[model samples]
Target: MRLTGTLDPVYNLRYVDSVNVSYYNNRLLPGGGRITVSVPVHNNRFSAWVPPLPAGDRLVLRLRYPEMPDSAGRILDVGGVSLMTGDSIVELSIGKGTYNPRLKKFALKADVVTGEQNIARLAYLGAMRLRNNITDTLRKKLYEKTIDSMAYNTAMQKASELRDSIDRDFIIRHPSSLQSLNILETIIGRYLNKQGGWNASGNKRLTEIDNLLQALDRSLRDSEKAQHLITSLDRAREMKLIPFTGIMPDGSVFDVASLEGKVFLIDFWGSWCGWCRKSHPHLKELYEKYKDEGFEIIGIGEEFGTGKEQWDRFRKAIAADGITWPQILNDPARQDVVSDYMVQSFPSKFLIDRNGKVVLRVLGDSEGLLDAKLKELFGK
Candidate 1:
């Protein structure tokens, strides 16, 4: 199928500099075609021109500035006229022109955006959309429940799950009526005031929490459109036996591809794991000695049963401990990485080589042990 963009900022991007774009073997194109473009910003409005694109293909903008990638800056990712931060609003035009009504709209490439809040928004929107589509997609695919049951119960379940998730991970300051991640105690507190559930008049607390979370996440931002594409992208990757996003306790975003070019030792852990946090100093020392030589270690925390609020606590714990490498939050929802690496314990590490291949799978984390390995591998 042929693919392209539209005349919208969400779809349009002109290279501010030519050095940023590259071609991938993922598709066949000449001159290292621009993978993704940052729609230009001017006035209070931001818009990008997307050439007429085919429906099922994926596009990712390698947003960069001053010859370096904007690691923390927000870039608008949109579809149609929706200006957004972390996700993309699917163009009605795209849907009308390309997608069939019976098909599911899932994102295939989520990591294209490196911005943290941006990624969070993208994932949040994706989850919302996924929740909405349970009747249309999951139930049909899995044949689990009726559409009516999936809609009301599934959405409520998703919101409740989301509440438990961010309650610890994000320092939510939102009004109880504002949204879920903004404030859990407040949202649930308000829901309690609503008499609980759509039909209940006495359990207001549950009602308010459900409504508030629903409002904050409705429709999603344009940036999430890319994220939606990524969700679809993961299915494609699964065909290749690659893992999608893996949730960890650090609550940080993890990308299997981003670890390229460095030797990475990934540790799956938890804050409650006394053994996990204990490995930090040694990891710091390892990073200090081999960082220059291209050896690195990433801490992936498993907060699966611990839920979401633990994520914020997890980050604070790291800050309190002075953690210095990439970290990711892990949960049962996204634990493919752990399964992929076959992690059997806490403080587990998978030592990857410079070429991004898994080299040492069983190497235990020993204090000052990485320095010796670096010396052997790169001769420090």
Candidate 2:
């Protein structure tokens, strides 16, 4: 493959040794091999031949500039290169890249044009723009105040809408492209363990994901990455319908199915998690106010330390905090309780109605929303 790009005229190219190109088998994984080749530079333009790479490999190019002496100290510029490649002639320009003086690295911003159809490139670009925009908006909001459940839920809703829009517009346009498969894989991995937000219509969303997977090219659908995505969706669906059993802190057996006749909550938490502890008071109040009205909660503690010691400590802490709900301590050996619920993060919660159907699932405390939902389920 041929690599051609222009170097900044401000930097002397004499100190440059060779341009480095790195490729990873899977862009999702880290630690890949690198290939470096010396290229001739004449009048700020450089051309080099990259040894033929494997048919499908993600590429990254790096250019480090020479250090120059200044009044304050020595300054150096390193250009970060982002590129998309395919079996064809590729051209790139790098002049307006962002540079970090401390790390001496420059970040090059470029849209990659791969061997896939132009539609694939457009989809990738559009999706990336929406992702970055959502990230920036949330970052700014986070600086102003602590992120509460409402703010986080709202931001997540907006992001889900953006993702759905990208999928509907782009993936549908090029269902057979590898680019489309990659985009779908990303979305699948993101919500694999999450059941709420955009995934509120649990079974319907799972069905849609399955349909998309089936829509891919036969070869691509049978690939390892595709299989993994399919498996994740299946597991999430199965877990939603499965009833879990655990041992309470007091050595009593606790079965989730036993609480089928009441509106209940499955609170997955950890002692080490600050948010889990912070939410205890509100949960306690809700329990006390609604206990006689058939409101029940099953606290599932995700213990990381020795089971007995951690369980004892957690019991003491809950008592001290006035949490009188039934507590189920996780058995590290048999962790299906956590896995069945797809509890990736602490403070995960699921609200179930009298029929044992999940009404809501959220990562953090649902705050007033939980209270509101309980009231709706069992009127105060």
Q: Give me the candidate number with maximum lDDT.
A: 2
Find the number of clashing residue pairs for candidate 2: 2
Superposed on all Cα atoms, model 1 deviates from the true structure by an RMSD in Å of 21.0
* Per-candidate TM-score against the hidden true structure: 0.34, 0.51
- The TM-score of candidate 1 is 0.34
Regions of candidate 1 where Cα sits further than 4 Å from its true position: 1-252, 304-306, 363-365
Error of 2 at 226 (Å): 7.2
Q: For model 2, how does the per-residue alpha-carbon lDDT over 1-380 read when each residue is reduced to its tens digit?
A: 77676654443333444466665431222122245566645666666676776433456676654564442221233434544444455555544345677765544444333334433664577577768788677867777766766887788788878767777556676766666676786666456535453255566667777777777778768776577567656655544434778887678888877887888888888777889988988898888888898889989876544445677777877777677778887664554566555466778887888876676767775687687788788877
Q: Write the per-residue lDDT of candidate 1 for residues 254-318, one digit (tens) a residue.
A: 67677677676766677777777877777787788777776666676654223445566677777
> In order, what lDDT does every prediction score?
0.44, 0.65
User: What shift in Å separates residue 204 of candidate 1 from its native position after superposition?
Assistant: 63
